[model samples]
Target: MISVLFFVLLGAMLGAALGYASQVFKVESNPLVEQIEALMPGGQCGQCGEAGCRQAAEAMVRGALSPAGCPLGGANLTQQVAELLGVSVTIADADIQWVATIDESLCSGCGRCYKACPFDAIVGATKQMHTVIRDVCTGCKLCTQVCPQQCLTTVALPPDSRSWFWPKPQTAAA
Candidate 1:
């Protein structure tokens, strides 16, 4: 009985300490919801199936919506947000692949395009011919504008790199 009583007291003390620590270190919450609402493209494009980005973000917190609903947020930003929410997310079916293609023949290897790529998909040393690693490319088009020689081109996703998952077919009619 003494041992049990001692254990219970210790557990209560630990719980109280943790609760106090949490109150002391508590962080401001819902920053993403507010920020996303503010950053919304405001085209009022209800691509997220919600009335707008604000509604979609609320639904996301409620676990009733997917981040894919926000047409303006895109997959990259949405994925980062979903990670914070501890929720599963749907990948956006974005425009067909737009990987940056550098023409080695024309590439001056100035490294501007590599610096412009947001996904770090391009790699090379200074004065060395930089190449885009197609798989990692997010195709935000930032690199195309920065290429000094104007050698960048976006290509459609190859048949193989492209993913196609068919919806489950309905059973035969009775």
Candidate 2:
């Protein structure tokens, strides 16, 4: 009983010290980086030339990267980032985003594409046909590149409820 009481007292003291240290050593972070990271799609697919969304957000805040850099977020995200940074941007006609699709007829139940997906967006068991989870896919084309049977292909993601945006109002020519 005496040993148990001693251990409990030690644990309590250590916990208190840890709590105090955390408060004293708290690290400050840029609010703009946090906000930009929040606006990202959180795919972490490395398609934007950064290792992850947080790194990309830091780059954006540093002015080393453009707001239109994220392909996964598409035009809507570009507009949001531009607005946040107080910059004007034009969404190019070539800014179309693509998503991977498996041609069911060509699929041989191989799992290569599933293994290649960094986002875990492809699902299937070994020797079973794999399917792409549309919402989670970042269209990095990694799966398409690694498919042994060439069953995976990329197609333009059509505008849906979540992705659809209102077009900028047209102005008459001066």
Whole-model Cα lDDT of every candidate shown, in order: 0.69, 0.87
Candidate 2: C-alpha lDDT:
0.87
lDDT by residue for model 2 (13-83), tens: 99999999999999999998999999998867888999999999999888899999888888888989989
**In model 1, what lDDT does residue 78 have?**
62
Worst 10 residues of 2 by lDDT: 159-168
Flag regions of model 1 displaced more than 4 Å. 1-25, 28-66, 69-95, 167-174
What are the RMSDs of all candidates, in order?
A: 11.5, 2.1
Q: Given candidate 1, what's the lDDT at residue 90?
A: 57
lDDT of 1 by residue, 1-174 (tens): 999999999999999999999999998858767865664445444556787667877777777876555543555556666776777765634424455678889888888887776567899988888898977775557678878788888776653423433334568999
Backbone-clash count (model 2): 0
